[model samples]
Target: MPGGGAGARRRGRPRKDEPALTERVVLDAGVRLLARDGLDAVTMRGLAAELGVRAASLYRYVRNKDELLDALADEQFAGIDLTRYVQDDWRAALTAMATALRRHLLARRDAARLIAGRFTTGPHSLRNIEALLTVLRGAGLSDHDAAFAAYTCVTSLFGFVAAEQNRLSAEVAAGMAPREYLDRLAGRLRAMPADRYPNVVALAGELTAPDLAARFDFAMARLLAGIDALVAAGEPR
Candidate 1:
């Protein structure tokens, strides 16, 4: 438990000449690189530079770009404690897992895109997916539905975070507020005739709250609710 999470890998500072071979060290270093630079910036050469190891040594932990992406995904998802959900009531458990997964993915900013679908092939990723599937299967989902539900939940999270990241800008990062940004946007929307775009005019205020977390939660809840309804209707998992 001590050597876990982001700080876990760095429980003690690395000695000047020592580099850690532990998977946690390797994954954390990679994540730090991706967070600082975008996904494209995380080449073997770049990762080696961060870990202070020869590029080839990375193979012990990850094989290629695909493997590297998997590792990244595993690191992000490592926070999930599946055992808690395993004992929860079926539908409630799945929804809870969805919310937790979305929050974890969104917290990492652009990191979600790096891991969404690569889990099946990566060791750590496969383990994470298996954990989720195990929980779902116990709750009464067929393997097929469990897999599909997993896909839907993951994609929903990725899309939500990606959209939120796109809307962020350097100026906004510094001091520009969303309210100021939306005020200007509202002015532009006002210039259009209400009669021409009745729904847009009436719901002008609704579009302004681009609350990434709230919107993601609302959408995820609805999607899971639909999934539950479908299941009850005898729809395939």
Candidate 2:
């Protein structure tokens, strides 16, 4: 029984009690969707539905899904406590940062894949890069070397996390626990012909150990050793 013009106007207007939508709100909704349904579920339309708003409304905040993902990556970087590295030795600082990044990405589903290889110029990401550069420069690396080192460290961290996630997914799809799978894999390695693969057969247990933490630590130590050697060799700026 409502009049067409007046009713349409009333419906179009936001109520005083309604909360105003902001960029943060849109990003937050996107985060929740990413967490619950993985990165593939995050889209302008999906986020709008979650927020109970029109998809066009989200464009005011983020131009597209790629921008929204950059924001989410920025959000992840913001959680890292860079202050804790203020007094840390250069190696310790890098290790802490890498460890924190890996843990953060692993905590969210598809988080590593979401942020990996995406160049984000957002505030949080810039801050993290600056911190890394500072750490490398503090360790006596020249300006150019520090920049390259920082880039290497960040890319390595992202790459490692992406690979780790893939391994986890494969394990899940195979319907076998990680340890069980590793044990079976080790057994197969041990069965290989000694003449053709002596070293692999001889170290099957070490190669297929289920201790991801230990393996990660070992690899990180090796990477740091190489960096330290480069710093010692004083590679030209």
Task: For each of the candidates, give the backbone clash count.
Answer: 1, 0
Instruction: Put down candidate 2 lDDT per residue, 115-182, tens digits, no spaces.
Output: 77877877777787777777888888878877777778877777777777765546656787877887
Off by over 4 Å in 1: 1-25, 52-61, 121-124, 169-175, 193-198, 235-237
Candidate 1, pairs of clashing residues: 145-237
For candidate 2, the 10 contiguous residues with the lowest summed lDDT are 1-10
Candidate 1: tens digits of C-alpha lDDT, residues 1-237: 121345323334434465767767777888899888878888878988998877766665565656666667666666666546655466676667667766666677576677655544444455656767776666566778878877776677667776666545565667788678777666767667888987777777777766666787689679878667756665553
Q: Using lDDT as the measure, which candidate wins?
A: 2
Residue 84 Cα positional deviation in candidate 2, in Å, after optimal superposition = 2.4
Instruction: Report the C-alpha displacement of residue 156, candidate 2, in angstroms.
Output: 1.4
Error of 1 at 38 (Å): 4.0
Q: Could you tell me which 10 consecutive residues in candidate 1 have the lowest summed lDDT?
A: 1-10
**lDDT (C-alpha, whole model) for all candidates:** 0.67, 0.75
